[model samples]
Each structure stands twice: as structure tokens, then as C-alpha cells.
Target: MISIWIYATLFLGFMVLAARSDARDLRISNRLTLTMAASGLAAVGLLGGGAAALLVAAATGAATLAIAWVLFEFGWLGGGDVKLAGAAAIWLGPEATLAFVLATTVFGAVLAVLLLVLSRWDMMLEMVGSHWRTRLTADTISVPYALAMAPAGVLAILARFPDLF
Candidate 1:
């Protein structure tokens, strides 16, 4: 359907853009984030269901952003991760977004536990390194945490709603 097509386009485009943002010479700013945020929400609105559905997505998305902010404030998250969380909210709605967050949390926790069992906390620490109480330099950072998981969540939802993209 048209919705699926749009969602597919948006998903692919977002991934490409995000990846591009990760390039060595690229520079991301708040303006770019806002533009992407708008587009990302629109994609969710059109692809997920409708305006009504988007309303749900918005609420859920806000919750996701709020939680991310809290974590970020505690030096537990990155700005990019917060932005990704908000972007996902625009499409997933609250319930779906919650599902995404829960899934990501479980995934991350499992990964962490696995790392610990393997005695690789030091490696895991390297990613966020000595920043549990403060942020690292903005340069040379990976993409946001939510971004890594958002696609998986969206894909799972799309699987359930075959009509969606």
C-alpha cells in the first residue's frame, strides 16, 4: 500500500542519512536534528496508521525522549541517542514506543550481561568510557543508542503490521 511504500522509503532514507551523519567529515547540528525529527515523525504518522495513531506515537515518543534526557543528564546517554529516541516516538506512538524501549532495554541488558559473563566489562566501558557521570567529547562518537535499536523495533512492528512499511 501507499503507507508501506512511504514507510519503507522513510526507513531507508533515515538509515542512509544517519549513516552519512556518522561520516568523518560530516557535522550535525540542532537544526539538522529538528528537520530530521519532523520528517521522522511524519514518516511514522503516515506509515504506522494515521493522524490519530501519530498522536499516540507523539506521546510515547515524548516519554522516550524524557527518559533519554534523564539518562543523558546523569551522563548515561548521548545527545544523539536522545534525538533518536524522540525521532522514534514520532512513529511508534506511546505503546509501540514503549515496546521499542523495552525491547532495546532488554537487548542492551542482555548484551551487558553477556559482556560481563565474558569478562569484557572493560571493553563495554571503552564505548562510554569514564563518562558515567559526565559526557565525553562530542567528536568521534558513535550514532545514538536508540538509533541502533529503533530500526529493529520498527522492523518488528512492521512485521506484525504487514500493511505498514
Candidate 2:
């Protein structure tokens, strides 16, 4: 039980860090994503999930990576976003991974709408600092997708561990 909470804390912590980093510079570092993946595997093992559970988690992560990579290639998502999602899927496992992906898609759509609304407000964009102002004003919009990923991950975690509440 204590291990589960520890895992949750670590998972949320990484998600928050990833979101913040991506929001600030639109970059989710390789080190951070790798650490997240490793910690997820470690958490599963520590919780006595055994080899089969670990294998399932790993397979889910791999599948997420493959699919997200295709999206990245098509310019639908950034490389960092692909890696982060894959890492998150490992923590979520197979069952919760679907929930995470669905929640992330919904949150992403909401973010896109918000960005469209915000883009029309030049004053608001200016107040957001030059980095964001430039990005928001660009011909092609690039969202900090980690923002969606983080909250979706939280929701997935909660859904997977209803007893935690």
C-alpha cells in the first residue's frame, strides 16, 4: 500500500515536471522521459507485479511508442510528446493506458480550442511573455501537449486505483 502511494507520487511528480518543462520551452528532455520509464518499471517490480506484469507494461509502452511515432512523423505531435506518452503508458499499464490515451485526446482537444481562443487576444498573448507570444502568434500552432498528458495521467491513475480514494 505504501509502495503504491510512493509510485503514485513519483508518477505525478514526473508528469508535473514534464508538463512544466514542455510549457516553458516546448521541450521534454530525454533524461526526464528515460527516468520516468525506468521508475515505472521499478515501481511495478517493487509492488510485486512480477515478470508477467512488467512484460505487459513494457509491451504497452512499446505499442504506444510505435503509434505515437507515426503521429510524430506526420507532424501531429512532437518527439518529446511521443516519448512522454510512451513512458506514461508504461506507468499506466495496459488497462489504464487506454483511459490515459482517451483522456489525453479529450484534454488535447480542449487545449487546442483554448489556444485558438487565446490566439485572437494579442494583449493576452503579449502578457504571456515573448516565448509564448511568439509561439502563439506563429502561422502553425504548436501546443505544449504535456499539459494534457499530465492531467490525463492523473485521471488514469485515479481510475485504475479507485481504492486510493
lDDT digits (tens) for residues 3-104 of candidate 1: 666665665465446535633222334555576668766776556466776676667767778888998798756676677667755655555566667776
> Would you list the C-alpha lDDT of every candidate in the order shown?
0.57, 0.90
Question: In candidate 2, what are the lDDT values of residues 1-165, reduced to their tens digit?
Answer: 236788788998999999999999899999999999998888877777689978988999999999999999999899999999999988888888899999999999999889887888877887787887888889988988999999998999987787866
TM-score of 1: 0.60
Clashes of each: 4, 0
lDDT of model 1 at residue 81? 60
Candidate 2, run of 10 with poorest lDDT: 1-10
RMSD of each: 6.4, 1.2
C-alpha lDDT of residue 144 in model 2? 89
Model 1 worst lDDT run, 10 consecutive residues: 132-141
How much lDDT does candidate 2 score? 0.90
Give Cα distance to truth, residue 88, candidate 1, Å.
1.1
Model 1: number of backbone collisions: 4
